[model samples]
Target chain A: MQLPSKLIQDAVEEMAKLPGIGKKTALRLVLHLLNSDKEQTTMLSNALVQMRENVKYCKKCHNVSDEEICNICSSNNRDKSTICVVESIKDVLAIENTAHYRGEYHVLGGIISPLEGIGPSDLSIDLLIERVSQHDSEVKEVILALSPTMEGDTTAFYISKKLKSCDIKLSTIARGVPIGGEIEYTDEVTLGRSIMTRTLFS
Target chain B: MQLPSKLIQDAVEEMAKLPGIGKKTALRLVLHLLNSDKEQTTMLSNALVQMRENVKYCKKCHNVSDEEICNICSSNNRDKSTICVVESIKDVLAIENTAHYRGEYHVLGGIISPLEGIGPSDLSIDLLIERVSQHDSEVKEVILALSPTMEGDTTAFYISKKLKSCDIKLSTIARGVPIGGEIEYTDEVTLGRSIMTRTLFS
Candidate 1:
């Protein structure tokens, strides 16, 4: 489609580059930016650029950070001895939303996906192992909170093997029926796991 | 959720303000931008800023343009005598994509929606009437190509009443079975319209 101007076309193309946004949606977004306050576009543009230019990663856990260490890793109140391992800052946010875990985190960046040619070397697995294996370590347990996909399991297995020599214990989130899921609608594998792993009514 | 960085949090908030994006999708898009080449983010940011700062509107039709008058309005190749009235630039684009209409366009920006408190005075309806009314009249037809909704019908009725003083013909797009639509699945209203407006089978 012929846009009214080159600037519009360029903006639409750029907007369409984002995942899940089609050309029509991109055009709608661009047109919205055009009709909205100039300051809004400026704020969005500046925020994106600022993030791309200045956003740093936590030195210890590889989480996105303004400084070398993220707020989660540096907080004294969090359980430093129990680290939750997962992929990406998004996962960190999701886990934090649950408010169940008070442990420090180990962000692996991404799991071991051979299909995408992403191996152990591509991620921050070494940093996590080193963080757990330090002498006179306070790190006692490493919980693998990665997704239960094949790649996630593979990544957890590789990291656990490397941390075996260390004093840290390895664990994972249990696979069972979701907390609010109805038993009738639950899949067999999950329902069966929930039943098998059921603790005596306590 | 506590984001790892202020930059990320700000960007996510700004991105989430878009029509369909939520916080989670905003984070995903922002993270994707981070992992991609800085050039992509820079280009997107620059395009948005440039478009917002410099985008112009066609003087005659009020469509988005890079110059005073849009190409369609000024072009000698298009039928200047026939003006297609539309609700927004998106409508203009949809019609333009068909390559079916060679007429000029008069963008109303939005329809007369009482619920949204948008009246005829809020649009470019006055400008459209003025264009059709100058002495030494060149205009022959005014096509109401607005959507076939309640608001669209109201706006069309209003414009047709105003254009009654002019010697130009007023028309609307045909509403019937969409191309490639199955007869069994077609709605009753559209099927009835198709029958009522039946033409020569040639």
Candidate 2:
């Protein structure tokens, strides 16, 4: 075990804690940081600090934002009556990047995975219910954009049960063989979308 | 034309500046940082700052160090009289990991890569000559540990010329088939080592 300097080791340890980053990758990254210009390294350091300091979840929609309300929630052009519910902030970003959806968003933080000890109460489901109930006059459609997983299915079912008596229309994104996709190896998104868009089963 | 936030973009730009990291990889790294824990992200940020703050080149041997002299230069057990000159700090780490060398090190910062607009003057050749010519009675040998590249060869030749009149035995690491290496695709290290260790250069 060749012992690098304490600073290098600390940088490596912190990098290794990131998703998919191992010790070797961490060392490479740290070495890269060392070789970079002083200003560039400082910028990287400050950017990391600033990212955490600036970003916060919007009080209303729970989407990531640098202010009290997220851009989507605050935009007057967006459809306030349609709230797209996603599993996390990344999902919200993915949806926004498409530029096809002009609706507000709700991030559940995570899906309801009982096996992983994540129950319905662990997510922001209650807050979402409160938002819907309080803004009953404005909300007309609730789009479940959760991940295409068993946990996603369970959470959607739970939320749908809670909103059964409400006048709002419950829907999900279309599932089918995606564009430029191979039908043989189609993922859960394609499969789920295909099934959801299937002709009336009755 | 995906316009990420300025904070995210800054992180990506900084990551892209690293060796072997492309824009896509930089984006991936930024996303990883975004997903990382706040405390761990802060740790990484501070580590980058600390890495820049702590390490500096040793005044005596030019090896990277936190003090005026590097660990090898300060250590009493190492053979200080035999100075092994290399290209960079990474070379020092590589040689140290081998655990076969017990001599001191001198980092030239880089070799004489004329193709890359680097010449003897670009390296620490003058400083190395000064160190060698110093009135230190303990000096016995100078080992060239440069890579077996054209630039490395040119740099070694330049150094050897400068040290020609010095009362010290000059040698280089061997060139030959490496241990556990096949002759078909033997790298420069093994080939160079084999040649250096050869009885005659037929």
Candidate 3:
């Protein structure tokens, strides 16, 4: 193989670092960049650099934000009394995109996985609980929007135990074979979560 | 739907600008960056910017370079009288990595693609022709290292016609089913190229 310029190879290597992007895919991206106009490449480069520099976590919700508090947490139109607890900021955005959810979010940074050395103390569970308790009007609901993974379930269970003493309604995102999908391919974690989160369908 | 922060969405949009990457994949990449260590993300960002700013084309061969002439063109060990003609800079690198071809390279920039409105005029054909005529001790060989596509064939034919009067041995890379591949699963293009570039056992 001929050695590519160090700069071009560096760009490909950087792109390949992204999840699911292999070397071939990264090469395609680099080629695209090379073919594109200089103005566009500069825009992409500037955006990448600015993304990390300009964006920050909201202090109140731990969601990605450009301000001290995320827009979701600070907006008066949202249901502040009902905060959904999720494993990461991406989950918050996913739930929000559904448009059916009107409540704010609380990001836990990550789920609990004892095998991976991540525990309750490592996450933002304490902060979530503290937020619920400090609310003046008494929070109504705490919805768990963690993934269907083992760590997500473990974190949910641990959080549930701590919030059990509170009077708030605790629930989780629905679980089942995905919409219009076969059950055979469903992983053990999803199947287990589906069973655990099953509702009484009258 | 809760709107993703402008900064976060902007990053995703920039990622989606890459060829073959859609919005979902871009979002996944952005989330991965969001989860990665600060230093890693910084390095990737810096590398992307550096790639655009630091790289330039080699004046001698029209291959990608960080200096006036590429390493291959400047090296005294290489066969300066032999020029490998390729469709792109990537091809030059691909040939270089084999470490077998000890010669200079000429990047045609792209093959003749009438469907895409690309022609000989769109490529660096003129420069390549000029190089051959101007150089002393007429080049011994010009290896065609283009993809085995219709456009590549047309471009190669055009170049050969232009250099018919010159004293040079013209050759092309081999085409066939890959070493480990079964004929049953061979792609049409490779199979077709193999037929077109067939050689007799005699």
lDDT of 1 by residue, B30-89 (tens): 999999999999999999999999889899999998999988887889987899999999
**Tens digit per residue, CA lDDT, model 3, B1-202:** 2345787788788888887788877877877877777776788877777887778888878888778888888898988778999988767767777778988899988899999999899888888888887757557888888886788889989999998888788888788998899888998878987888788989
Report lDDT (Cα) of residue A131, candidate 1: 85
Cα lDDT computed for each candidate against the true fold: 0.91, 0.79, 0.81
Compared with the true structure, what per-residue lDDT tens digits does model 3 show for residues A60-93?
Answer: 7788888888887888899877889988876776
Q: Which regions of candidate 3 are displaced past 4 Å? A: A1-4, A183-202, B176-178, B181-202
Candidate 2, overall lDDT? 0.79
By descending TM-score, how would the candidates be arranged?
1, 3, 2
lDDT tens per residue, model 1, A2-86: 8988889999999999999999999999999888999999999999999999999899899989998889888988987899999
How many angstroms is residue A10 displaced in model 3 relative to the true structure, after the best TM-score fit? 3.2
Model 1 lDDT at residue A90: 81
Off by over 4 Å in 1: A180-201, B176-202
| Each model's iRMS | 0.8, 2.3, 2.3
**What TM-score does model 2 achieve against the real structure?**
0.85
lDDT of 2 at B10: 68
- Candidate 2 segments exceeding 4 Å error: A1-4, A115-117, A184-202, B1-6, B20-37, B184-202
User: What is candidate 1's CA lDDT for residue A57?
Assistant: 88
